[model samples]
Target: MSRGAWRDRGAWLLAFMHAFVAVCVLLPSAGVHAAETVHAQIAATSEQVAALTAVLEARLEPLVLEVTAVEAVDPAAALSAPPTEDVARVWITLDDGGATAIVLSGDGARGMVRQLPREGASDEVLREELALVIGTAVDTLRRDAASLASSAALREELGLSPEPEPPPEPAPSVEPPPPAPPEPSPIASLPPLPPVVRTPPPVEPTRWRLAGMAFYEVQGFAAGQIIAHGPGLSLGLGGPPLTLGPRFELSGQYRLPAAAENDVAGLRLHSGAFRLTTQLTVVRSSRVLLRVLGGAGLDLLVIEPFLVDARAELMPRRVRIAPALRFGLDVPVRLAGEVSLRIGAGMDVDAIGTRYVIQDGDALVPLLDPLRIRPLLSLGVDTTFVGHPAFGP
Candidate 1:
């Protein structure tokens, strides 16, 4: 109807068309940017999963990273697969001796391994250290990839081609040369030389290793209604280190006397044990050695009893013999040359339960009951000496 109205309507339509065109142009690029996220697959213990993921997120800043927890991550498997820009895998493994983290790049061609400390540091600190290592590896891989891509792009832009291999220099023409004159032979041919006979030196057998260990241990046993604890000392001698079979060891242990008292009566008990065990090495490395041991032992227990009443006569001490079966695990961490710090835990089951009774006005009352099971923990040092072969012809 009016000229001003018509002009206003045309301007509004033009603005709408331009806005629509701009939105269409921006949407695809935004989607592409959002899709370019780095997918991180993490394999770690259940306790460490959350902390590791959080630390990684913090360290890999500016790059969009999506972390997923998995049961396991195999670096070899990751390396075998074709690498992509958006995927990475990390694995954290822990043992009694130490910890380690392995990182595999999205490009199957690269990977990194980091050894982490197993002690002294807080969990947060360790996780941060791991994250830092993984971040560095990923960044290095991406930077290399970017550099390669940029180099390729530059080469294409410059329209450069690979230099053609120089035609293998035409093999030099081997010209035929004139024959030379022969020289004179030696005078009076000597008798043919005698055939030489060679003999190999005798091979030496693998030498045996002798190991000695001195240990301090704490032992726990249930006596009556209370648990009795005592300190013990042990000296052990171990046989050769066997490659295909378990090694053998013989140890003697003596436990100091410990007393458990009750309102009615008190008792003091001590024991000595001799054990012969077979040790099968499970994990052996430069830093640590782990072994599982099992064996049987003979125990001599001495018990002394006293009555609260001053007039009551002191009961004579009694000696009991017990056969015990034991199973244990030990780890020795190398501290210096030929010496290591050893820690062990074990359980012993007694074959015979000895019950002690006190005479109380013709009615025998149980003063102490037999301990059927005992638990032991030990700490000590181990030293090894390699023996030389015996002198023989």
Candidate 2:
């Protein structure tokens, strides 16, 4: 072929890929994993993947697109796509008309939606088509990457390990043995069949319905002269993918052995807090869910003191609302229906870093100066409410 012929072929190829991938880019957003559905799986050889990836990146770079590569396999068995596509998958399906490039998009929302198939494609041609699929995924990723960057659950859900299924084992070859004496005196009747039972799949629940969350947390406070550890109880409400919206929580904590003077000093510390939090799901699957959360809270802390000596004297205890910021990881195991057992681990940082206050005469002083970040791990239950709560008409 002449230089002009090659140039024409290249131009046509580019135009064809652009048209093919354009369909994927324009599809409607379905689940919250709209962008992730495009995070893809491909069926091809390692060599084919390398060649395809190079071509895709070369073309996608000008458009500033990025895509992750799942491991490639032998192209011979790359025709049938995976059984389920939690994320989009790309492969070539065969018909009478040679090879057809297909992209199965959506996370079950649009179940195995096929892209515009290309016909009579070669290795080079198929590479171009697969690259186009990733390019389309990159387009939507731009819209969600910022919000998803902080979500570890979303990243884990997109775990694109496209390990090729092992090929079917070949049947063993056998030789017939010589038969001796054959005696027949048996009934030809077959045994009765077992009863057939049908199990319907559970209705998939939407994540953010009105969800209630409860958990136990252990809070710690320590500094120079003060060392305190306390158990806390937390309850929260919010929903519609309970992990996406703001949840209001009320929690209370208590620790013993506080310092007090003059007559009474049993030294017990009590604290209550109201927190507003939002959780970002990093990954959500059939059996488990992972999330990262951020929130702000005000702690209403009260101190009770016990005097060691009979002659000790001091004013009343002090109460204050210390502001704090908290970060957490919530991992839940999805139970049967709309219920989940949640295990949460969190850390709280006091904004002002001041320690617990003690009563000295009529003034409040730092009993545990320079407070530290509190760490807690909790087990809880989460459930979604039936109807949306309605405020006034």
Best by lDDT: 1
lDDT of 1 by residue, 1-393 (tens): 999999999999999999999999999766644544456666666667777677777887666667677776554444344556564555565434355665555654445666787687777777777777878877776666343233223324335553344587787888789777876668548787899998899865455656778887766676435444443444444433434236677877777776765556778887877788888777767777788999998988888887776766687888888898889998888887777888999888877775777677889887766577778888888776554211111
Residue ranges of candidate 1 with Cα displaced over 4 Å: 1-205, 223-244, 311-313, 361-363, 388-393
TM-score of predicted structure 1: 0.43
Candidate 2 segments exceeding 4 Å error: 1-208, 223-266, 356-366, 387-393
How does residue 147 of candidate 2 score in lDDT?
A: 29
Candidates in order have lDDT scores of 0.68, 0.54
Tens-place lDDT digits, model 2, residues 87-199: 44444332333333433333221212223344655767656665565556544444443322222232233343344558999989887788867876375476768988989
Deviation of model 1 at 225, angstroms? 7.0
Give the winner by TM-score.
1
TM-score of each: 0.43, 0.38
